[model samples]
Target: MVITKTLDTFDSTKKLAGHSFTSGWLLNSLRENDKLYSQLFGNRLVKDITAFDVSGGKGFLSIVLRCTVFFVDSVNDTDDVYTTILKIPGFDSFKNDFLTDQLRTIFTEFHKSECDFYNILAPILDGPTPTVFKTVEWILDESEGCIHMEDLTMRGRTMTYFETVNLAQIKCLIQHLAHMHKNILCSDTKIWKEKHLKSSTGFIEVLDMMNESVEVLLKKCDFEGKSLK
Candidate 1:
């Protein structure tokens, strides 16, 4: 069965997920033990919460929001703060039938793949990736769904754009990729089988279809150059 929830703008100053940010929800989501909570919020309660939409993320599939949590520490009676990012899928409604169908398939597979990644692959991987605090999937339609994950930005992690890459950074990225590949190569294939994740050939099939369309267009135009094979 699939579950659905209306995406609502969160009010930072109120209770979230059963408790105020200063009371229990924040620490519980972080998986902090009770001892740590007593040591941290001795008496003071969480006062307010704030969220800012992080811009410049170029993607049609999802939207990102950065949340800042505020609370007063009970021990010293001082203010303390923390942050977390929320990733929400971007499928509200579609006008174009072809595009909508294509995107629905793509988004569905993407969400399932990510869920598999967090559930199956991440535990064994020693690669550079954000710590996932939680993941929630919302069923929108029969074949469409969205995923929400913990924001890595709260931990000072930033996205690396192509224009900002340096040679050193590129090398580091390659090393991280290599480490991930090695970990996957060493893991048992049964782990993936248990999760019902199989390799996908849908993208390659789509490319082939596009190539055929290109060939037809080229013939119709009577182009002389080599065909896009």
Candidate 2:
């Protein structure tokens, strides 16, 4: 995996936003986008994380979520904080590459899959779209290629995940993703039975699994080679 601090490591206002980080390791989690926001908002005791910035995609977009209110009560200041979600292009060499676009498309498909697998993970993954709390009142910034949700606090309310990583917690996270897949993606309830549907279904599924552009290019190349003979 080319995963690195090159993603969320340092703030480059020079590049996009004038942000800086003391350590690169701190950004490893943020490189994936959603993980960074989850860490920030999921912590109940955390009032804030300073120098907590994200930027380093093709476009240098940035935003910070405040964890706590500085004053006792200021509706004007509001109970919410700021967080940023970024829109980035993956390729640098070409305007866009077939494999890179395929990966992005795969993420979108994964996001849909999350809704399908939310209740049964391990065998799957969940990609969540940003959503704020209506009852609690928070802002969920789900935009571009990233999900940035904020307006989270350490106050009262039954549902809260604000702590470090643990085995049980990991399991819980997995279950959560499963639930996301089940609920959001509208899972295929009969996977075992669905297998018996039809041969064309399998073919179409395989077709969907592939990148159209790649397939087309491959066909064109095959035709040209045959023509040369």
Best by lDDT: 1
lDDT string for model 1 (59-107, tens) is 4456555655566442432335555655556543323533546655665
**Alpha-carbon lDDT, every model:** 0.54, 0.35
Please report, as a residue range, the 10-residue window in candidate 2 with the lowest summed lDDT. 132-141
| Residue pairs of candidate 1 with colliding backbone atoms | 12-49, 85-151
**lDDT of model 1, residue 44:** 36
RMSD, one per candidate, in order? 10.0, 16.7
Clashes of 2: 24
By TM-score, the best candidate is 1
